[model samples]
Target: MKSTWIALLEAKYKNLKAPNYSFVLDEIGKNPYAKVVEDIRRGFSINEDTDENTDISFGYVLFLAPGRDFLLRISMIAPYAFLAKIKERGSTSQPIVRENTQDAMELDVLKILESHGISMFDEKSLKIGVPDSGKDSKSLYQWMFVDEEIPPWS
Candidate 1:
């Protein structure tokens, strides 16, 4: 039987969605890793031309373990519209902005999981780089370990 934590995570992903975009969930059950990837492709209109809409692909991968440990990896490929906005604001500021945004988003996700009694172990923000898609590169963030009991504050 699936544990309560697993059930909660599953329910959360199942209900997750974005406006005007559908999500796809891919479940991977392998040794030492029971993972679920939730993906979405969002369309943005950068120009008045309808044919110029760009699609941004992003997703989160959730890793479940046997005990009270879990991991989440988030990847986002910026759309042309988003890149344009960043460029308009000054291309040099993109890295800093992206890092801060990813950190904020990771914190939010951790908070949600914590509300379910999950404690964080380790967290990391991967360096941004080009993805196989050949579009804009992606920013990756990962959080590892989810415990049922909260750790004592130092």
Candidate 2:
């Protein structure tokens, strides 16, 4: 079955022109199809255009710790920000939440961004954090937000 997050993203931006993907491609380097070895790893969607290259679909993040395939519900709680619980593929079950908020799904994503030098917010600022383009963090943020601003949540 199609991922709910992906579907919602597609539905919302079906009419907009596609975004430039070479930006992300430049980051992943020649190994677009990098080998998958880690049992649990973080990945950004780039193979499929609609997954991350759309004009508004800023990011498509996946986790391989327990499984792959999940995303923020497309309904943004704040401008350029999306948050919601995630269910297993094809199962309308409860969201996967752990006792430690640090181990939370959202944290998983933030950590990946952090690894790339993106805090997702600048120090003492509410605006969406700027990323190092050379690190291709800009592309990742592009996949995360359509426009930069103080996320409504703050």
Q: Tell me, by lDDT, which candidate is best.
A: 2
TM-score of 2: 0.29
Q: What clash count goes with each model?
A: 0, 5
Please report, as a residue range, the 10-residue window in candidate 2 with the lowest summed lDDT: 31-40
Error of 1 at 75 (Å): 21
Q: Could you give me the TM-score of model 1 versus the true structure?
A: 0.19
Model 1 weakest 10-residue run by lDDT:
76-85
Query: 1-154 in candidate 2: lDDT tens per residue?
Result: 1243234333443421352334433433432222321211434432222233333433333543455454432212112323223355432222222222455545665454434433232212222222323332332233344443333222
Candidate 1 residue pairs in backbone clash: none
- Model 1 RMSD in Å is 18.2
Instruction: List TM-score per model, in order.
Output: 0.19, 0.29
lDDT of 1 by residue, 15-124 (tens): 21212212212221111111111111111111111111121122222222122121232211111111101222222122122334454433444444344333332212
In terms of lDDT, model 1 sits at 0.23
